[model samples]
Target chain A: MSEIVDWVAVDWGTSNLRAWGIGPNGAVTFKKTSPKGMGKLAREEFPAALDELLDNVAPARSGPLDVLICGMAGARQGWLEAPYLEAPTDLRGLLDGAVRPTMPDPRIAPAILPGVCQKAGADNVMRGEETQLLGLAALTPGFSGVVCMPGTHSKWAQLSGTRIEQFSTAMTGEMFEVLRTHSVLRHSLTGDLDGPGRAEGFAAGAAAGLDHPEQLLGTLFQVRAGSLLSGRQPDWCAGYLSGLLVGTEIGSNRHLIGDQPVPLIGSPALSALYAQVLAMAGARGEPMDATAIVLAGLKAARSFAA
Target chain B: MSEIVDWVAVDWGTSNLRAWGIGPNGAVTFKKTSPKGMGKLAREEFPAALDELLDNVAPARSGPLDVLICGMAGARQGWLEAPYLEAPTDLRGLLDGAVRPTMPDPRIAPAILPGVCQKAGADNVMRGEETQLLGLAALTPGFSGVVCMPGTHSKWAQLSGTRIEQFSTAMTGEMFEVLRTHSVLRHSLTGDLDGPGRAEGFAAGAAAGLDHPEQLLGTLFQVRAGSLLSGRQPDWCAGYLSGLLVGTEIGSNRHLIGDQPVPLIGSPALSALYAQVLAMAGARGEPMDATAIVLAGLKAARSFAA
Candidate 1:
């Protein structure tokens, strides 16, 4: 049976699903996304959703569908639990398989690779950031420093020459949400601190966090009690909290990173926030459009197949 | 009629209300407390509840009542809104004056004294802790150094040569409640972390918080994902969160505290936890019973009249 696509590269995570149709030349012919995030959907329903995405970008071609996927889909509850590839392994060895589900002749997108950790006392694993890193490295030539990928779990990766150095993840974004939306501190934190987090609130939060890395939790409570008992504005308290988390992340990673220029591949707003924070921490950063990096990453992976 | 008792002293806060009866000799003839905490009563009903506490204890005295009070009863919503006494001001100056509610006979209970803060760029206010500090000073002669008071709003007060030099409040305990019981992190944290936070699981969490303060939120997500994917225990996650807040408190106070020994005042269990944390942070600490401090404070305030 003839299939319709050459290669498809997909990036799926907790909240969103994205895919790109690629020609042999590494050019994207179509790109599509859906709200069916891995966090919301069941494993059995993933194939139907993926097929709908492909059908929207369906074209008349006579070839087998070749697809590469990554992200939470490689997680345990994901479509197919892609095993982790240890640190230092780039894109090639990490590919799970060319998945083809029964619902459509168009292949079910293959699960991208995940990272493994066997170190004593550390059993953490990651699935999507590695693919993003590959895409990021492919986009920027001679890019060797820290690749700051900010999200629910912000990652700080050290790329030494061509080999990936050590990396660490900070739950800065998620913690910010918990503090602002769910925690008792929420009463004191009013409105978005600034511009999808690029505001002075974010920068201030980042700076404060770095300077007073130890008081993150203790200082947060002062927001509620201070505001209620003393009439402090809710917004300032919010900004103060943002400062704690962002500042801590910047401080923790500042020493481990290099003076060499780096690339940021994630939401533009979050990427900007990270850059602003890095500057405050004495680290200079140049913004790399996350979309460009994702596309470039697909190309880099395609080069291996060719 | 010869006045049998000159006045009364009451310490009222969120969860407890306590009062002391004094004779002309400054000797406490009677003492009583009730669960009439500010948290349990309505704003309009404060006077009645306070009256009930006094009524319960006043019967022991031979004559009229002269009462001096402190804690939340001095706040805006308190009895008569006794304004705060600035730093270096003794109990006499901080007193806003006595209030005589309609139901009472001896017609006089001195107002509570409030805490004052002058730290620039930070909201400064005090409530019940000031009274506790005053109480501590009266009880302990020539005592100086830091006082670590543990509760929902934990305080670290700097005592120098019979005066409170400076103080900072940490929201450690409150944050612990929110993270463990309220936020999304609640899913990852279940059951109590063994023995009122003495279990090894809690210790491990504290260590994680100390080692990676920024990874707090990210690690918390693992509480949900870990259980969903690989069956990680939820209670351990709760303990880990406890450690983060406690660790942050220890870290924030590191520089400001410079080798001053910590005198902790709380329950045996909480004192033990604080001591454990202080040890982890390399700070020296000794537990001091709160009951002793309260008694000493009452005696000291009485001596001022002598």
Candidate 2:
């Protein structure tokens, strides 16, 4: 097939790098991914890793091919430092602060977009999520309301139309992992949270977290206590823990959410869980596909640059 | 220099075994500690570990010497299971539930005291803290107040005279360890919290936790954000975490504390921190020496048996 590649869209995160080849018609002609993310690469290794991924993929060109990148690639320790653009920032203007790193391959022209930062109360920052937000904005133009992007470090962003007014980060997922693996709660928690008992436990935990977030320290020990006293299963314990953390996150940030339905941008499974918990808290969670939003975000940024 | 031993008092926990040689006149003639706690010993290994620690200390006798033990030695997986006594339990009656484990040496007749359990509310259990509570009760003959025992798993007990009304456990220390070693917050945390910045951070965290315990999920990330934005030192982050957890613990269980001073039974440094935080929460922390209370408790129990 004789294809004329117009541009490339790359999501260079901490642990993974994904790229999609865009044709002149703005359609994805080819897609590829690698584990050589910003976390594994030094500043000197970025160009080679990019070249390796795009070597046979990019069409023969007389000049450098334009590549638009987002995420940790623009972090201080990534391929090149693309300083954060402080909020309230317009999603369309993300490409304005894009930094161009020196490339070894003359046929590669990469522009890394800057992440978002909140300089006010409880200062916060996000790299890749900014693009995800941009993608969400692209999918729903002039999007307004709270956007929850759940992950290892879950981000809660307040959006006024297409501009991010402010944002907050919660260490819920990370906290859950640490407690489940390294704390005494590990004794009572095992296996994945897939059972019915886990689901019920999750709901109960979410309720407890919402009702008594201050009681987190006391409630956590209940995993072991319940196991010893009532012979509660490991799955239930895991579910309860998940519910508690998610519930606490939602409860703590409920003030940020208005009457508008909260849009959760993340993996389907995680977003579903968040949705379930949000429903329990008398709120709505609209699950949005992460990949779709990310691609849309990169495409929007590309068009804005052009 | 010849001495006659009356009985042995032991605090045999999960990680360490501490014993005191009681003289005929109720004085501590010898004190020793070992890492051969219940966690390190199998059912058969317990006799040998105890013998090693008790060697050349017991008086020459054909009959087994009476040895009173407390803590994890009475757990289900310990030498012999000394089942838990449900609350509301009388401190003086702890010996009634003591179980004697079979020993290899005829000269070692060890009796393990049962820990207390609360089957109500959130379902709680404690092995060593019961003994500590007994010690606290012995120190204050008619003690009627909330007792705070801080450690790996901190316990807060409501005591009326010699009876334990109810108790709650918080995995504060364990949570701290997990967050510091395994969580993403570890990146912004390190070293002992001793600097001025750390103290300020600790106070601020404690206040935040006490004032708005619901904000824990959001507040935890502030440690990292502050570190990234304002160059917050590692010690400050550690101190802030410690304060937040401790403060939340106190804030959550504030209903347990009346107008009376809260007796804090633990080590000096930990007790001091708790005391400071308690003062911030508008409660007084009366620091009580742990060893003194434990010895007093054992002595009282010994006399009761006689």
- Best candidate, DockQ: 2
Clashes of each: 18, 0
Q: Lowest summed lDDT over 10 consecutive residues: which window, candidate 1 chain A? A: A94-103
TM value for model 2: 0.94
DockQ of each: 0.34, 0.74
Query: For each candidate, what TM-score against the reference?
Result: 0.83, 0.94
Computed on C-alpha atoms, the DockQ of candidate 2 is: 0.74
lDDT of 1 by residue, A169-210 (tens): 666776777667766566567754443433544555566677
lDDT (10s digit) by residue, model 2, range B1-306: 534578889989899999999887778889989999898888788888888888887663446688899889888788888888898988788888889987888778999988899886578999977877888877777889889998789999998887899888988888788888877688788665577787888888888788877777778888777787778898788888889888888888888888888998888999999999999988999998888888777776666662
Q: Scored by CA lDDT, what does every candidate get? A: 0.63, 0.85
- Give one digit per residue, the lDDT tens place, for model 2 in A103-190: 8777789999999887765678899898888888888877789999998899999887668888988888888888888887888886
lDDT tens per residue, model 1, B161-231: 45766677776787677556655457656664464433555676567665665555445444444444454
DockQ of candidate 1 relative to the true structure: 0.34
